[model samples]
Target: MKAAIFFERDGVLNLCETRHGHQVVPLRLEQFKVNPVASVLLHQLKLAGFVLIATTHQPAVARGDLSRNELDLMHMILRRKLPLDDIMLCPHDDASHPCQKPQPGMFLEAAFKWSLDLDRSYIISDKWQDAKAGQVAGCTTVMIRSPWIGDDHHDFVVDDLETAVAKIGLLQNNLYGREVAMA
Candidate 1:
């Protein structure tokens, strides 16, 4: 089974902000901000031969906070700067749609599109629901620290992107070495 790595966009890969007492998910291209360690981690993951994918729940579009075109522009910026192989977004709100986070639909879609082996894949997110979705999809889930979530279920936890990258490297080394020894 081939391995892949999936990332959540808003708080994990970029800074999320609140405006007018509402949480904003950076819909504009100019508002898009990448985390300081994102590029470094992405480069390392690419070197490790992991297929990089982004899985996000963008409820802003469903809530009329942002249009689909604007969201596309924002993703274009991300694609230009990151070593992303694909981006999958759930553009529906929780109330109107159940296919959002905590639902395995998005991850399932990604696995199908990319022919990913969920058992050998990793999903990184700063939200509990996102982690839950990944977990339900049979992927190793890592939670990045976030104030929004008090507690949640995840396979692993890491301080930041760099630390997450290091953990992945260690896991890959151990797994690959075991495979080689067996062979």
Candidate 2:
């Protein structure tokens, strides 16, 4: 099985508007702006043999604020800009919706569908929700410093995506070395 790197969509993979103190995700394709730095940073992880997966919690769709078709268009832009292997999204507001962040459903589902090794996988996000979900899914959690990242149990905290990528690469290499030593 392969290890995957899960990235949060709003802030980590793409740029979002800051509404007051909180970040606001784009509701329409016109408002969407893909982050340029993400391309180079993600390429580093991709070259390291990690499956890049973009994960999101689009509650606006549940509230009838953002349409699924519009979300698809935004995702298309992300795919064109980055080297993502899969895009996993939970378009519901209800707590019962298992795929929502802070719930391990999306990661668990992705692991099952993609034959990923959850223990070896890593999750990168700017929010506490994805970190909590990663914890529950047994994946290493890396948080990028952002106003939205509250007090949470994350494996590593970095100033930028570049630092986070380097951290993950180091961790994966360490794990690989230990496995090789055992063999």
lDDT string for model 1 (9-77, tens) is: 888777778667444778676888877678877988988888899878887788898889988987887
In model 2, the runs with Cα more than 4 Å from the true position are 180-183
Model 1, 2: alpha-carbon shift in Å? 2.4
Output the lDDT of residue 129, model 1.
Answer: 78
What TM-score does candidate 2 reach? 0.94
Q: Which ten-residue region of model 1 has the weakest summed lDDT?
A: 144-153
lDDT of each: 0.81, 0.91
Model 2 lDDT per residue over 59-85, tens place? 899999999999999999899999999
Which candidate number maximizes lDDT? 2
- Write down the lDDT that model 2 would get: 0.91
Candidate 2 lowest-lDDT run of ten:
147-156
